[model samples]
Target: MELQKTSNGHHDLSPDRIPENGSPVTRFDALENITEGDTFLPNKSNGKIETQFTDFVGKTSFGMSIFNLSNAILGSGILGLAYAMANTGIILFVLLLTSMAILSAYSIHLLLKSAGVVGIRAYEQLGNRAFGRPGKILAASIITLNNIGAMSSYLFIVKIELPHIIQGLLPDNSDYWFVDGRYLIIIISVLVILPLALMKRLGYLGYTSGFSLSCMVFFLISVIYKKFVTECPEEHSYNKTVPTESIYNSTDGMCEAKLITINPQTAFTIPIIAFAFVCHPEVLPIYTELKNPSKKRMQKVANISILTMFVMYLVTAIFGYLTFYGNVKSELLEMYSKKDTLMLCVRLAVLIAVTLTVPVVLFPIRRAVLQLLFPDKPFHWVRHISIAVCLLFLVNLLVIFVPNIRDIFGFIGATSAPSLIFILPGIFYICIVPEEQEPLKSRPKIQAIAFVTLGFIFMIMSITFIIIEWVTGKKTSGGH
Candidate 1:
């Protein structure tokens, strides 16, 4: 038997064991063994070696991996950012956004570092290795919650904007059932989202993702274009049911962009920013798929993706906020005149992009549910179909009942965003990386511990603020 090097610098005990080469098996070596159709068992098998080996044997290129990760980072969060800027003024928003982007990149570093040590790529698997089944469950739960929030946010956009698009298309102002976003969401979900979600594999949607991201680019360009064209004192009305103290309550002076602004609603700024950068769950998967998946290479992929999104997000928020200033609603596009031909096209693009994206986002949540409930079972269509149906049902309910898109963004950002981007990755790194390689007292581990602490603090503070808002019956006017 080929003996593996143990942490103690000795060969592991085994029958007919060969002498160790004094080097622990690398992830590439393990991958190579699996490539040769051999079982790539680690020095200490977590009973998930096969799953890890099979799932990560990818052939995707570096450029493709970058594209995949960048797409993951790009989502409906873009819609709320201008509102985030509205709440936290331009200077503060830029600082907060910049800080979150840096922290997100750092968090990915910790995750990649931990994964390299264990030769495991899956996020939940790292959790399992670190803290067993409970860890696995917690990781899966966080991913499910995060993705469900995302799906809900996307659908919420559909519910809010789809009806308006329909209304704008008709010849007259006569009320139609299809013009009601609530009913429209249901119909679209049944006809469009369900079929797409039901697909056994979403490999065909790569081009769809490209298209969806292109829509966001179109959105950003439109936002920029509107900033120049839209007059400073433009008299715009809220398209949806906005909060009491919104557009009508705005003062003439409120038109000027502020260097700093703070209010009760400012508590949500971090959470919203957190929500936008919660692409950590997607990081490892992209790493696994990368052509020459090294921590450094994957780190480069993540850094580039986050940097690109950062520029896009910063510009979008700045220009979007500049366009409406205090008059900007939670959904930036909602700030625009729906009758404007360009704005109409922008709305349709957003609706189509988000509608198609729901199915893609739903995949992870459904997969997590299956992993939690049916860990040992092989693929069965009944279970698959049932889970997808059930997940969509639950998400549809959330999209319908949730007051606005901001709540979805804030709540998930306050909770799962921090966990995925900070808490879990920090904890996983501190726990999974061996003491021999780096002790608990080491700088890296110390930083990771601090990272976990920061996440907890952010979560507790944001949740407290949100609860206070609920108790006082003061909703932040981010969306209808």
Candidate 2:
């Protein structure tokens, strides 16, 4: 087996051809002339030269593609976004959601354009080609951190909801119901995630998307119905009209005020909402799996996915916010606390949906990290290790810290959200290629400006929050 470099710098592999080193190679056509019996010559690595482009062969349809993209965006974030929006006003929430949708769309488009130029399918690979080792490391770190935060958020949701579901199934005074919430979280994660992680292919999980989508819809419907049907008494109302000065009178008062006040903290939350909806970078593998891998087809898939996600998000945010009104809590479980069996069932459905959805969303991140860290090793150990580590972290989180959903959202938004949603996409776009191609070139300048500006704003807000929290020593429910 011999490997020869073509004049164009691409490697050509052949079996029979005895290629000399440092030869003046003209074209791939010259190498085609060599044959071994009836077969083409193989390369030194005992592999035959294949075509430059691999054929796209995947079972995902446009609908599944949209479902996959939407599920990625709608994960754990939707659980908390309404409360974040309620902190701001309804009008402000709508405005922020719109801005986030646009930003997410632009960021995803830029990532796809970069993928086209580099002829790479993975984000880390593209980052390596575009920026260098440090850039690759940065990309991997950002993705890993973002995913850890996401998984933590999911774990928090599960911790709150799973115990209730278990208790509901048990007798009212059953002695067997002595399981700790944190222990239950670990058990639920193992029972739910390990098998899913061990699967050889991802396509099987596609069906679960239908279940997840249904759960999300049901959760929304339940909230809407509960709000309309079960009315809160005027005395029971946590809603109050207070002067701005009264808001800052005491530490506990400030915490309550922060929930209702529309200030810079509220303004800064736009990027968190944006982070929740930005699923574009993850679309590369989906695009590569398309039956027809053309620019137009890829664009169509992206456009449809983004549009579907936008509508779903808009509806979820509006309904969730309006349902809770001024007193909305971060987690949907807390919002459903006052409801009866029907609403409890809705919460249960959401918990199941999110639990199933977690492995699918987190699998890619685990795969990427394992590949980066242990490129040459078999994947079985990696898969097991990743799941164990994730579960252990969740257990520790639940044990040592009890986070209210709002604090969890704030931590996620401030730390991991900005890097994943803003910094990575902009850097990937700017650093990937020397110049932009075609219709993409027409928009790069504007896109670059918008991404940079948004990134700056997000980082500023995140940093400010961190500083304020540190100085004031005042922590919310989810703060570590």
Candidate 3:
């Protein structure tokens, strides 16, 4: 594959050919040339390219795009925010959250600028453009790992929450097979998730994503409601055994909110924030589907979506932390009394939301794997079904053996989240943006270099701290 020069003198890695009409080409021209494994190549057989921009025109409106991007931003990570706030105090948590939100928006700006320059909308295509096939594989692999971590976290939620929900709804509180979380996760994966994942297309899942967002809204409202009605030193139950240090005897210092906190556990704070703000993978797809796509317009959609999620995340963390303070569990829903009627409803809604979302998250991981392993192969039912099954099976095993959900949030957030939100965008911008437009020492390129450096530092520091904690046998339940 040779690099083709665009009319503007920018080198385009896209395989799109020019139309006979001699009009300017857009990213849509590249979309026309997408091949198996999400890679593209020039169609040498036909000397002329087809103009199909009208077919995709005006398909997605601005309001709808905002909704979709918001849905992508929100995930199981919200359940961990209160725990994050507990480790870091209110002021520090808010500062970190605000910075992450702004940084996420800025990274999206970088991505949009790079994509526009190369006339390539796909994330992996941008990788290919920037650093060739190895870059493409690296991008796909990080996406796969990031999303597998997402799926594992979702299933982990199901493992912890589903049984309590089942036990709550039953007549007898005695131990039963139906109330075993491991068994329930496996069963649900087979019965519910597998079938949905096997489908050829997921246009219908958009409705489910909207429903999930609604459920999260209810969850936020419930958290806020509990803050007013529930007081400190209140009765809270733990589903798992906790250490003596975890128990609170008085409301004296425990309930008092701190302005800032310094502890080993605080290392997980930024990663958790990173995990919550990762909607980058979905951003370009939303841009592609937008009615009138432009770098500025899509940036607006991203900003609105990130700002809305930022508010939601901050409010949820504050209320949830205030309601339980230092006693809150990593999984916020687990900290409440299992018999609480309102909480049961919240658990059911959360279970439904996360369960349905696993298949959606699985789609990207499967695509990345296929793109890497089966790049040139045509669609085959056997391959599709096999990959979905293997992924679910692996995630189920991960959920069953993992000691707690915090590890998932910490490790995944430390690794994949930074790569997606910081490292990749920074590299793409630095490499794909022509030096003529922005010189090596220019503000944008220097900022991009610093951004990549920051990502590497964060990843190394977080991982080192987590490993030290594990080695010292300091692993505990909840955020700490």
**RMSD of each candidate?**
7.6, 8.1, 7.1
lDDT of 3 by residue, 20-111 (tens): 34344454444333321132343234786432221123357787778767777888778888878877778888999999898899899999
Candidate 3 backbone collisions, by pair = 330-478
Per-residue alpha-carbon lDDT of candidate 2 for residues 79-122, written as tens digits (9 for 90 to 100): 66666665565566667767877777767666766565554445
Candidate 2 error regions (>4 Å): 1-56, 169-179, 239-265, 376-413, 436-443, 470-480
User: Which predicted model would earn the best lDDT?
Assistant: 3
**348 in model 1: Cα distance from truth in Å?**
1.2
Off by over 4 Å in 3: 1-64, 173-175, 198-203, 234-252, 376-386, 400-413, 476-480
Which 10 consecutive residues of model 2 have the lowest summed lDDT? 34-43
List the candidates ranked by TM-score, beginning with the highest. 1, 3, 2
TM-scores for all candidates: the values are 0.81, 0.76, 0.80
Candidate number achieving the greatest TM-score relative to the actual structure: 1
Clashes of each: 1, 11, 1
lDDT of 1 by residue, 1-480 (tens): 464432112232221122344344542233222321123354345754432332335566776666667777888778888888877777788999889899999999998877765554667767765776788799988888788777777788788777777677764744767677778788888898888777664444455666777887898898899999987544553322332233323433557776666655677656778757777777765665566467778899899989988999999999988878777777677677878888989999977877777776776676667656765456577877888888888878877776765565567656887788889999988877667668899998899999999999888987886777667876553321
TM-score of 3: 0.80
CA shift of 119, model 1, Å: 2.6
